[model samples]
Target chain A: MTPEQENQIRESFDHQSMMTTFGASLDDLTPGTCRISAPILDGNQQQHGFGHAALTFGLGDTAAGYAAMSVMEPGHEVLTAEIKISLVSPAKGYRLIAEGTVLRAGRRLITVEAKVFAKDAGENRLIAVLLGTMVPVKPKPTAT
Target chain B: MTPEQENQIRESFDHQSMMTTFGASLDDLTPGTCRISAPILDGNQQQHGFGHAALTFGLGDTAAGYAAMSVMEPGHEVLTAEIKISLVSPAKGYRLIAEGTVLRAGRRLITVEAKVFAKDAGENRLIAVLLGTMVPVKPKPTAT
Candidate 1:
């Protein structure tokens, strides 16, 4: 990816307050691919003290959206049109990592997928997989 | 729904820290339906100052899970196997409400769906719809 494109993705990601709330960070970026990780916190757990599926889905969705954005034209933004996720295993770990890849990039719709892994003691276990479609749109005008 | 069943659902929900972090509340419950709502907080927003898709999906998923739980046998719990969501409109509003219902209940897997609405100025607009499968499981033993 061009330096300008990388800068754009980082700037856009910085504006997402949800990522901040979850303590998620962008770990890597490349053309049509993105990786994100977040530590598992007590506030993000389900009844059984495992990482909530919402946490998994949130990270995966954002990572996938950024992957689509990476391949889009300058100043273009992407929005999720639809997403599906399957929980393959319990998320029992200290942190979660999501790797997203673009399957197809079109003028209007982009297909993306993400694999989420739970990391415990440096071991990673696959926990969930997500597939989604993103729509490219011109950035909305900022308030003056 | 029986009072015992309602109490069981409420107690189970109270154990979910993710719901507490989102400030989501169980608003209603019946034999095979559940409703949940949460205010749109600044911490849960996307880059465009709108409600994040994570918030919508979290509410919908939990509501649908609870709907499945409402009809399960005693000592049984439900976990999401897979879920798919379509964002029909931008989530721009004061709060989001998700109403979930069981489409079909079975011994192993239950089919469920949820409709999410964005509420602003006492008006509601359809924002998203979700379909999912829930698997019934015996409650895990708590730590002694």
Candidate 2:
């Protein structure tokens, strides 16, 4: 990705308050790919003291969404139309890492997939997988 | 649902710290059904100022999981196996309410669905829909 394109994606991600709430960060960005990571904290745990499914879904969705956004034109943002996730393993770890990849980029719809891994003590275990479609939308005109 | 069943569901929900982090509450519970609500706070917004999709998915998934749990045997809990969510509209409202129902209850897997509504000025608009499967699990033995 170009420097300008990377900067655009970074700026947009920075404006998302939900990421701040989860303490998630954009770890890497390349054309048609993205990676995001978040630490496991007490606040994002389920009743069993494991990372919540919502946390897993959140990071995966955002990572995949940004992967779609990376290929969009300037001023075009992507919104999730639908997403499906499968929790394969219990999320017991110190942190979670999500890797997103774009399968196809079309004019209106983009197909993306994300794999989430639970990282503990230098080991990573696959916990979840996500597939989704995103729609690109141009920014609305501002009132004069 | 019996009083004991209600208590079990409520107690389990109370122990989930992710719900507390989202400022969500369990609104109602009946046999094979559940409802959850959360306000649209600033901390849970996307870059466009609308309620983040993660918040909507979280509420819907939790409500559906609880609905499945309501029908399970005592000392049994439900965990999400797979979930699919469709965001039909932007979440711009005072709060989001998710209503969950069981489509089928089986020995191991329960099929569930949830409809999320955005409440604005006391009017509710459909924002998202979710379908998922939950697996019933017995508590593990505790060490003496």
Candidate 3:
């Protein structure tokens, strides 16, 4: 994807309300890849003082969608069809990172993978792995 | 599981932050089963106006965890270990519901399945299915 396309994707992501609710931000973007990060907040902590699994999954899922969108044409959009996430370890940290990469990009469907990391004490620890399928759809007309 | 255990599980679910963030609530609770529902909001929607997949998965995953918890001992809690969700149809609706049932309840690991439904115009449409594993753990003392 070109720099212009990347900016477009970023702009679209900004329109997603879930990102604002969770305070997640796009950290990096490249061809067929993207990363999202968020600082750990009390609102997202579970009973164990660890990051909630759903919050982690949401970040990873969004990153995977962007990774697939990074390779699509300007007039197309990507949506998640399915996803599987395995929590490898408890996520206790100052911030969380989700790095997504497209494994295969096809005409209609793109398969992607993501790795979730927790940054604590200046060290990043692997926390989860995710696999997802994203489908390209016709662009929705911009709202008036 | 007894009725007392079911009520205990319900109390725990009420404390989940994701549920509060998305306005989801526990609709029904039974032995080895649970149902969660939420009114569709713009914050949980995608570009095409369909409910976002991550929101749906989060509901289903939490229901699955509660399904397992319902069968556990009083002092234990269940946490999501892994999950696989397949979206069968686009979710367009006024309300979303997720039904979860335990497939197996072992000493430490439990397997569960959940179905997500979208209620629109007085009709319920199946949108996704999720298979998940939950691990039972000793309850952690809440921080003061």
Each candidate structure's count of clashing pairs: 0, 0, 0
Candidate 1 vs candidate 3: the TM-score winner is 1
Tell me what fraction of the real C-alpha contacts between chains A and B each candidate also makes: 0.78, 0.73, 0.41
The true-versus-predicted C-alpha distance at residue A122 of model 3, in Å, is: 2.0
TM for candidate 2 is 0.96
Ordered from best to worst TM-score, the candidate numbers read 1, 2, 3
All models, DockQ values? Answer: 0.69, 0.63, 0.50
Put down candidate 3 lDDT per residue, B1-144, tens digits, no spaces: 777777778777767666776788998888899999987787776655677776888889988989899988876778789999998988788889999999999998999999999999999999999998999988657631
What tens digits encode model 3's per-residue C-alpha lDDT throughout A1-144? 977778878877887766766788999999999999997777666555677787788889989999999998876677788999999988888899999999999888899999999999999999999999999877646641
- Each model's TM-score, in the order given? 0.97, 0.96, 0.92
Residue A89, candidate 3: alpha-carbon lDDT:
86
Instruction: Residues A1-144, candidate 1: write the lDDT tens digits.
Output: 678889988987888888888899999999999999998888888888888888999999999999999999877888999999999998898999999999999998999999999999889999999999999888757621
Q: Report how far off residue A135 is in candidate 2 (Å).
A: 0.6
TM-score on 0 to 1 scale for chain A of candidate 1: 0.95
Q: Which order, best to worst by DockQ?
A: 1, 2, 3
The lDDT of each candidate is 0.91, 0.91, 0.85
In the range B98-141, model 1's lDDT, one tens digit per residue, is 99999999999999999999998889999999999999888758
